[model samples]
Target chain A: MSERAAAGIRIERVVKIFGDVGITALNEVSLDIAPGEFVSILGPSGCGKSTLLRCVAGLDTPSKGQIVVGGVPVSAPPEHLGIVFQRDALLEWRSVIDNLLLPIEFRGGDSRAVRPHAKALLRMVGLEGFEDRYPSQLSGGMRQRVAICRALVDDPMLLLMDEPFGALDALTRDQLNIELQRLWLANRKTVLFVTHSITEAIFLADRVVVFSPRPGSIADVIHVDLPRPRKLAVRTSELFHGYAGRIRTLFEGMGLLKEDE
Target chain B: MNRQSLQGVAITTMTLIVFGLIWEAGVSYFGVKPIVLPPPSAILRELFSELPWYLGHAWFTLIVTLGGFALAVVIGVALAVLIVESKLLEKTIYTVIVGLNSVPKVAIAPLFVIWMGTGAEPKLAIAFLIAVFAIVIDTVLGLKSVPADILDLGRALRGSRSMMLWRIRFPCALPSLFAGMKVAISLALVGAIVGEFVSSQRGLGYVILSAQGTFDTARVFAAVFLLAILGMLLFAAIVRIERWALPWHASQKDYSPSA
Candidate 1:
């Protein structure tokens, strides 16, 4: 477990252009994420927020600038990095527990050694006894929970989530947001979460980084002074509403939401 | 099997019996000569009396079909992987396979006989050639059908190429591979019989040809009946293996008694 230390990320003036059309997906985006801080990137659809997360995960290489993780330059996927996608992406053929052990198998680690940790992660997410259920048999929210367990199984230092709970219903989304905040409080790993929901962003992050519409760069970063182990009731609080209102006003200023409409 | 499947079997058996009786009554009413078309009873008699002789020929054909199918699976899967993993093979080798597949396999059966003689080798080769196409095409589709997100997940884990192929792509392809095997197995049987028809001293195909020469309709009917039974059994065997191998697949649920 000594190798399970959290790693900070440095994204320095990253620029990404796609295809021959010169369509700029990300333009000179830069941010520094402290170790163990939970940062949510909030933006609208096609705002390149997901692309920024992909760059940090090393699934896409920026056309310009660089990303460094834990004092090492990113050329390929960095060590102990885990990622979760919006679709859950669980292998249907493998059972829940086996899906959790996939990263271990890919990394050439002993699966038998990681079985206990896998079960513990499942238990943490309220999926205590579904170890043998296939992904097809699970509900959407449950499948996403298993996906989260799979990401954490190898104890990745840096976790990147791209709209991980965006597909769920409103109630399930709130439940997952609370569970995710609890998990972060326990582990304190550096997490870079990308989402479009304003309430979800501030509820689960120490700082929410807002991005402008495409050719996306950071528009604003708002620090949340909310206390740890925050309950659902916190969302109704004055401070929480204040943060959401601020983000809405910013979007309105950018013409993303027209006041007349 | 459960009660429903057993009932299904019973219904199928009853239908076959009724169909056989209709054929028998029609032949007697028409006063058809045995040389034209023997009644079902005569064919049954011929089958029972010469059962050992039929078994010997049937065994040879079965062996040839199985050998060809096994070879097709091994080589076809390997070829598909190569084509998928390399753009060069996809452009060159895959195009050639598609072009050749368009040519009717029966047209080339005689070529195999001339090359490999009347032994089992020629029959095996023809069967493999006919069956390998389905295996390659379907396997290629399966290998390429893995979801992009799954591929990205594999990449994020820093998995090697072989690891991705083995752990992710291969298992994901199993259902499609089984579908190909079902088609290939039947094609292999057709290839085997075609090979025997072109040139052969043994097997059911030889029995049918010799019976036709002597105008022994009963013997010809016996061999034909055996061939039909063999094809069904082989298809059923493939289906059984598919069910066992892919319990995870959605198709299995449709036929499941509980579902």
Candidate 2:
């Protein structure tokens, strides 16, 4: 309810050194995400994209620089952040509805008041009838959908997702990619999506941020400049192919990827 | 699965009968002394003849075992939680518990009898001592088994420490807790019997000890049979409760007769 704090995220010159091991994960990585903008971070495995997102989520502290979420600097986990991992991370003991209702439960409010919202969110994710089912009974894609509903339960200003659909098979991953796009379009929540898949980044994001390997620094930022409500068919389009090619070429230049795949 | 369970019971019954027949024939053929090795029929005859007397002692044993087991669970879980929450407890209390677990529980039974008297109190004290370590160790293992991603999920939700402990760790620890409980329950029974053996006016262990003293070998066998039934019944109860409490665990899958 704080209007002035609604500005999305300002991550200024963040660096992360994993102490003890003496490995530098991120170095002076600065990026600003506008309110309601969808940005994809495409990086190789050790490029610190996950580390950067963790810093923004306040799960990890940057060795230097500042991360501001909704006009508040994050030293501890902020109340207005949603994070989804590659693993769905649903509690096996909880039913789907209860899992989705976790944020409300965590905040210690009357969670019953959020029941209707939970139902509506489940329906929006096409998981309406499965509310009573345990996570073990669900397919991987379905579990990830429930996880996304969980992340959105609090209607956070920013959703920091680290390969949310990375574990699914190719067909299921593509399906979730479209499902996620539709959800994001409706909610218009600012999102920082991380993935290694170039096509996924090109197809889903308004901008794609690339990174170099260990002691990861931002290598390039490419704006997709594509239209919204993107369909799977868009991957066949010239502009989508152009974006993917450019991203691949950038990876090649960093020597992280082979010249031809 | 239902058929498999039936088959398992049927096979067990057949095996017991076959083994009994072989034993009885061997003892009769050899003209063995009844005191040295009684026939299965003689043992069964003894068990049924003293059914009422055995039941009284069995009931006492059951009560003490359950009482001690319940205390072990409560104290063990609280200790495990403290160990998880505080580094001081983890370093000092956990290490101490690990060290205490190595001591022979039978040796401790006499000390409990001396301090608490030759009553259910001594038996329960001994039983709790026997069972607490497994429950604490297993529950702590379960509580800590959550994936890094799951812990991150808790952090991202801005979950308070209490919330994380209750909603996340406790439920996650249930399967391991039950496994520990299975081990603990059996050990608790052993402790109660050991305490009864040391010095007790009542219970099956007392009956067995007195029967052996008087050379009533058949009665001893009968008491031993009752103890076996008691152990199986308690174990089966835990298994049933585990299925009810944790329908999501793979072990609870209806496909196994062990279910």
Top-scoring candidate (lDDT)? 1
After superposing candidate 1, which stretches have Cα over 4 Å from the reference? Answer: A1-3, A259-261, B31-33, B254-259
Candidate 1 lDDT over residue span A1-261, tens digit each: 325889999999999999799989899999999999999999999999999899898899999999999989888889899899999999978989999999999999999998988898888889988898777777888989899888888988999999999999999898899888877777888999999999999999999999998789889999999998899999999999999999999999888998754
As a whole number from 0 to 100, the lDDT of residue A118 in candidate 1 is 87
lDDT of 2 by residue, B1-89 (tens): 58988899899999989999999999999999999889989999998987898999999999999999999999999999999999998
**lDDT by residue (tens digit), candidate 1, B1-259:** 9899799899999998999999999999999999998899999999999899999999999999999999999999999999999999999999999999999999999998888889999999999999999999999999999999999999999999999998999999888898899999999998888888889999988888888899999999999999999998999999999888776777766432110
TM-score of every candidate = 0.96, 0.96
State the lDDT of candidate 2 residue by residue for A1-261, as single tens digits: 112133488989888999999899998988989998899998988789999989988889999899998888999888867789999999989989899888888888678987888888888878878888888778888889899988887777888899998888999889889888987877888899999998898888989998888889988999988787788999999988888888788877877677555
Interface RMSD of each: 4.2, 5.6
* lDDT score of residue B95 within candidate 1: 100
RMSD of each: 2.1, 2.7
Give Cα distance to truth, residue B172, candidate 1, Å.
1.1
- Candidate lDDT (C-alpha), each: 0.92, 0.88
